[model samples]
Target: MISKIYTIIKGTGKYIPHLRVKNEDFLNNTFYDTYGKKGEKSNQEITEKFEEITTITERRHVSKDLVTSDIAFFAAEDAIISSKIDKEKLDYIIVAHNFGDVKHDNRKSDLVPSLAARVKHKLKIQNPNCIAYDLPFGCPGWLQATIQADYYIKSGDAKQILVIGADVLSRISDPHDRDSMLYADGAGAVILEGKESDTPIGILAHTTRSDTYQFSEMLYMDTSFNPDSEHKDALFLKMNGRKLYQYALTTVPQAIQACLEKSKTPLSEIKKVLIHQANGKMDDAILKRLYALYDIKELPKDIMPMTISWLGNSSVATVPTLLDLILKDELKPHKINAGDSIVFASVGAGMNINAMVYKM
Candidate 1:
């Protein structure tokens, strides 16, 4: 039999902006006044109810002077340091994001200099042989990049790859949109290294699907159109909360199950699942459905660790950042030990849903 090559998570790192935004910050907000329930209740009361539903008390946003690439650089640096690999040895750098560097004034995506190339420049990788690219797979972008890296390793085409997921939704968000409160800014990265191992450690199997024909506009922004068009209101992120929630509940669980089946790993063997921190309630519901698929009635408390309560939704950065925190023991009461089986799942724009089964 041919020698099996596996991609292992060598290290992880994250960059969270220093700025913290509390729910109360939006008190008397124009967004809530117009679209939210501020008309019927006080802002404070509305904030409380908002917190109750999403469990989001606060989130982070980059400073006015920072851009998406700047934050991504910090995260990439940390991942490189933790991996202890020479900078020149990095064979690939994949960045997953929606909007590139957003001009704070205009709120436009600046993608001329691809975000991956910017990250490579920031990392000071002088080797022209090192290839860098971007993957815009919605919130599941990071996981998707990891899956791709796994393929490269298995194909013997790459040795070490840095996959970074980041986004500055705060820049693209409309202050008048209630969804603004649901978005944040952050970056997370991981170093995937190829290693020869007999045991099945690394990405074992994955599944992904996109239903954009029907739900293409379910969670998207209004940009990427002709500037001269009459769609002047196409600048901010728009989402159908209920429809997206229903989509996640229906699709995410099935994707995870399919991945598990492909991996031939039992649900009971999964130690923890690093799911996208989209919405606290919706994520919980997705996990409940996942457990139900295996006929497990009661959901495991710590099986699904979440940081969205404080981190909000940082688009693609949620999973990797949460994974980094948990791996570092910074997120207490949740830990991943050696030989543990883990699942990573996410659902987002493109109406895309994906999941991967990994062995540690």
Candidate 2:
């Protein structure tokens, strides 16, 4: 049986510090300068390459003193405020992140309880039922948390739920790798309020699939802490870009189709497609293929492809940050009506693909 509809009461976002690092800045400060000095390339050539490979023009980064939880706190506070639902009414807080406090062995799940306790205390909520927990699922974590909250609200277990996605990519990337150029840091959130209605503005249908066989495509571990190794940079994100791209191309479209089928919605009914924004070229290619498969002329103008070029990719925060940008007018004007559909799809490091269809 299908669950009843739930409304998104509010949404809030907090980006990492607004330090603008331009392409030229990278060329001048990094090893790329050596190539220029040898007369093999010019500054303009380096800048063009940076722009071509990354969608981020600028991205946020946490200061050395800050951590992932700090960013999560900021985003959660904004979501609580925007919901206009008193913090006292918040019964649950679920945070989604790929990385968290370094010292915590349990990561988000165990780390959030104390933080939630402090927040509840500061808000002066008399109820002791408020609970907090963490979920770590890479880039698709936010969507997963949203669906979980929706179920909680539908089950009449909570009134207001706060879902936050936060990550500090700068600290997780391999400093010497060229791929590290594609990472950044940021946080975003949404507040869900339970409601029963035929009107569909929140989540409609969601589907998730994972190929564990491809798990090695992306992996991270604390190798730096190994007693046998003297290298302090042992812990970092490792990804095979070529393999990841191939997986995304093969799996994401199928996921979207499955979501639409489950929702009983047709491709023609969709007004906009909000993908993971992982890469500009990949997104363009996917949309083109979709257009051909559906034989549709003139794709919707509301598609948003904004990503932090200099900041790299913030994984789970990407979708929410893009949504935040949309709400803030980064997405162009369009005709999104009550019955129109919007498809959100993500292909992340776990070799996982998630797609959801929403009626706007």
Candidate 3:
């Protein structure tokens, strides 16, 4: 019989830069001066604007002194140390990033090798068989990497894997764009070890689906900064908010249901639902629909929504980052017990939807 693969989440860590940009600070310092006419707008005017639309209280940005890889390295080091696992035993490092040190090169292939080398040197692991690579799938990249790593470890190709998700959105965000307000910079890391156990806290089942027909609803590119040109905003993240919301509301539930079904677990048995920290409204909508459909009342009151009023979205790092936050709290009374389940879901650009069930 094939040895059943078990991936235990040994450790989790996250890093955010020192610099903090509050909503009021952003409006008073930049928004009004840049967008206001004639003269700078008063503080009251700025406050009014923020209150009109959903107000984002604060967000963290990578300091000018640090780069994307620096954040990733910090998180990775913390995770490795926290897990108390032998560094020499780690045989793989997988990075899920949408943006990375783009100033040096545009292609992801070029940057990943440099990052891997830096990580290997810092960790001081001299295993010649160690391998490192990158996976790009926007917000769902981390889940994809987890499944891939599990496959590698199960095949005896690797003993341990360090999965890192990092993104620096401020670098690509168009300063003049309001949509840019939704993004922040951060990194998260998780150490997974190959082990045989009846109970596993790692991935139990994961599924992904893509609808290419709606690909153009959200996108990013690099173009000139000409103010007069119609394509001036092409370089920054753009999304048809209404359409994207519709897609998310419809797909995420189905994905979660599929994951639970495949794992042979009932939705009501899940202890917590760790959905992507995308938006407060989107999350609420998804849960409401779930409650109505499944008639399950075990949903915990401690809903984790780290993205809503703070970290807009960090692309691939969202899920891992949230996981780090939960673990740092010691899991508290909200701890995920053995045999209990948690649902991880994300719906992002490319109209992609993914969900995974974890049996703790």
Candidate 4:
């Protein structure tokens, strides 16, 4: 039998910020609705409801001095160490983020140097052949970057690629909006490498879709709801939470099902559904609908492991960070054995959705 080259995750790493902001932390702030009016409900009531729906009780925030690229570099370093590979051997470094680097005091986005370039410089990688770049594909950015790396590896153009996702949503979050409580800061990284094998062992299949026509503005940046705030000129990340949740419910499951069918893998073989940790309720609904696709009702226990209760939503960092936790045995009772199959999926801004089917 002829050998085939496949892209497989060689190693993974994550950086969870030290500053833990709890639900009570938002109780003192005055929140405003999307309509720019003061929140009708009391801050206490709003906080409790938000926690109940999103299941995010506490989230991590980066140190006042650390920026997005700083955390990205840290995650990359951890991944490199975990992989035990020479930094010079990497053929590509793709950093996925949205707001670049925004400082605490000044909420301006600085992307001139490109976060990938900054991370490469910080890594002290002198190889000119190791191309580095950035990808800002909403929350699915990191998974999308991994897909890009898979193409390069399969094409024999890249043997090793590092994909990093880091976001400091706290700085870009609108403090006056209840959604701000869902935003967190964290970074995760994974190194994908080409492996020759007689049978497929990794990256079996993948699918992605962009629904920009009708849902282009579901998630965007705008002036804060608090018009009188000091950072009025700066754009804060905003979302039509209800609409985005609806879109994910309608499309994300289909995308994952398509990927599974493309891989010719049966539903029974999928051991895990590692999806983006956006909203806990939304994820739960999406999974139920996914099973509804096959006319199944009862969902498997522990098919999905979530960290949002403590980690919050870190945009592109969510899925990879969750993967790292399970891989390192930090996430309890969740383990990936030699033959277990898994699915990775995410949906976010750009109204984009993607899914990848992999085998251990």
Better of 1 and 4 by TM-score: 4
Instruction: Write candidate 4's Cα lDDT for 1-360 as tens digits.
Output: 799999999999999999999999888998887677897899889989998999999999999999999999999999999999999999999999999999998889999899999999999999999999999999999999999999999999999999999999999998898899999999999999999999889899999999999998999989989868777688999999989998999999999999999999998899999999999999999999999999999999999999999999999999989999999999999988888999999999999999999999
Q: Please give, for residues 9-54, the per-residue lDDT of candidate 1 as tens digits.
A: 9999999999999998998565433233335566677778878878
In order, what is each prediction's RMSD in angstroms?
A: 3.2, 5.0, 4.3, 0.7
Q: What are the models' TM-scores?
A: 0.94, 0.82, 0.84, 0.99
Q: Which scores higher on lDDT, 2 or 4?
A: 4
Which one is best on lDDT? 4
lDDT-based ranking: 4, 1, 3, 2
CA lDDT of each prediction against the hidden true structure: 0.87, 0.67, 0.71, 0.94
Give the TM-score comparing model 1 with the true structure, all chains together.
Answer: 0.94
Name the regions of candidate 3 deviating beyond 4 angstroms.
Answer: 1-3, 28-55, 102-114, 199-201, 222-234, 296-299, 303-307, 330-334, 337-339
Clashing residue pairs in candidate 4, if any?
none
Worst 10 residues of 3 by lDDT: 30-39
- How many clashing residue pairs appear in each of the predictions shown? 0, 10, 0, 0
Candidate 2 lDDT over residue span 1-360, tens digit each: 454647554655656556554555555523212122233456466557756865555556676665677777777776666566777677788877876653322222235444444444545668677787777777888888887887788778987888877887776654434455667777887777877775565677889998878464554543322233334535757666767777777777778888888888888778778777677777777776667667766776655455655445778887776766665565456333455578878778677778888765
Better of 2 and 3 by lDDT: 3
Candidate 4 structure lDDT? 0.94
**Where does candidate 4 stray beyond 4 Å?**
none
Indicate the worst ten consecutive residues by lDDT in candidate 2. Answer: 29-38
Q: Compute the lDDT of residue 141 as modeled in candidate 3.
A: 79
